[model samples]
Target: MSDLRTELSTNLDEAAWEWLIPHVQRDAVIVVASDLDLLDVGVAIASDNISSVQQWIDQQLMVKPSNTQVGNWNSDRTKKFHTLILQPYVLVQEMAA
Candidate 1:
């Protein structure tokens, strides 16, 4: 866990919506549920724990941001989200208000 944590920690970052536009443009953004540990999810995906990721996806806990969500973010240029990259997908979780 330490090594994986170290590797993932380096990739963990906070990003504004504008910085993520490229990923969104490519339809590579995934919105992770707030209840889940963002790092844990990254670790799971990084380690290829497909069953865990599949379960989350099946339950709709992980998904692409809805149009409403994108609309809101588009309107608020200053908003930021916790983000992580897992190859083709970039996982994002909304920050607690």
Candidate 2:
């Protein structure tokens, strides 16, 4: 887990860093799930401000394609290569808690 955290922090591009730092500081869990040809970095913001989350996602897409992949993987090696698409949505239940 620590290694994965380090890799994410180190490999994230400038745009990612800029968008992620504040969320991270606010205790959001940022998960980077990937598939064969797409990387979906979801930010679980614990807030009701859905617009803010969407804006952040839009900013990231402006810098690069939202469906961009981080690396190449052989399809044969895995059954399904579907990753969690980075959709910034407010987890209302979690937020209420």
lDDT of each: 0.90, 0.30
At residue 60, give the lDDT of candidate 2: 51
TM-scores, each model vs. reference: 0.91, 0.22
Worst 10 residues of 1 by lDDT: 1-10
> Which pairs clash in model 2?
none
Number of the top-ranking candidate, with lDDT as the measure: 1
Task: State the lDDT of candidate 2 residue by residue for 1-97, as single tens digits.
Answer: 4454444344333232333334434544233222211222322232234775466556553122122221211212231222222333111100111
